[model samples]
Target: MDAQLGLRERKKARTRRAISEAAIALFLERGYDAVPVAEIAEAAEVSKRTLFAYFPTKDDLVLHRFADHEDEAARVVRARFAGETPLEALHRHQRAALERRDPITGLCDVPAVVAFHRLVAETPTLRSALLHYHARSVDALTSALLETTDGVAHQELTARLGASQVLTVLQELANTNQRRINEGRSADELASLALAEADHAFDLLRNGLAPYA
Candidate 1:
């Protein structure tokens, strides 16, 4: 029974990948807005109903790739090693991600990944959808922070504020990396600088901005 279930899940994953790949290929060829959902459904060889079942909205078709990362910050915080601060854990993760050329970190210069970034940047709907997704990510991180035994007054507000600042810093870091990549800088070329910037950013988060004043 477990084997059967595993096989079924693998099949579903393949189907989803097929649909996403087809949709992205078409979107890259002809602008995202110009490509219709029905066309994507047909290209994926799935019924429109099946496509909708897999991805509820057209925006989702593009953003589905990001779903796995929605709670990444929260997960990192929750899984931090004993005695490690949340900021430290997140900073370590960001460094590792950049080292691995993780697409989410904007350090990947793969043609497809670069194209994906371009698609999102150029599409208004995808940007709006991403903002909603970021909000959820911040909320998840806040909840994770609240779970930790960090004693402070107004815990909820502090958690939310901290999560917001951390995520925004990371987002801006990624945006900067992506901009440099888009300008033709290789990930290998930017590796040292990226790590340094990440260290500095996390230090500011850890130590507060009084140093800059």
Candidate 2:
């Protein structure tokens, strides 16, 4: 039974990948709104019903790539060491992602990732969907920080503010990396710069930022 279930899962994953890849190719070639779901399904050699079963909305075809990172910040907070503050944990998490060249960290210069980002930037629908993902990440991070035993005064307000600030810092870091990549900077040429940016941003979070002009 377990083997059968494993096989089924693998088959489902394969189909989903095929559908998403086809959808992206079509979208990249002919703009997001210009490409119909029917064409995506046809390109994937799957029935429309099958495609919908895997991805409920058309946006899912492109945006699903981000689903894995949705709760990542929250998960990092929850998994922090006992002595670690939420801010510290978040900083460490961002550093690790940058070091590993994670795509969500937006440090990747791979052609496919570049194309995917270009599609999102050029497509209003996908850009809006990206905002939705970021909002959800903020909410999840807030919840995670609240779950920790930190003695933060006004926990709800603190959680929301902290989460918002951390996410904003991350978004800026990603934009800087992506901008450099688009300007023909290789990932190797930018790693140390990315690390320095992370250090600068996280230091502000670590040490209070109240005195800034």
* Best-fitting candidate, scored by TM-score: 1
- Model 1: worst 10 consecutive residues (lDDT sum): 147-156
Global lDDT of each model?
A: 0.93, 0.90
Error of 2 at 205 (Å): 1.3
1-213, model 2: which lDDT tens digit per residue? 999999999999999999999999999898999999999999999999999999999999999999898898999998999999888888888888988898887799999998898888788888888898999999999999788747869988888888899988998899889988999999889999999999999888877685583
The superposed Cα distance between candidate 2 and the true structure at residue 29, in angstroms, equals 1.6
Query: In the order shown, what is each candidate's alpha-carbon RMSD?
Result: 1.0, 1.3
| Top lDDT prediction, candidate number | 1
Error of 1 at 212 (Å): 4.9
Q: After superposition, how far is residue 135 of candidate 1 from its true place, in Å?
A: 0.4
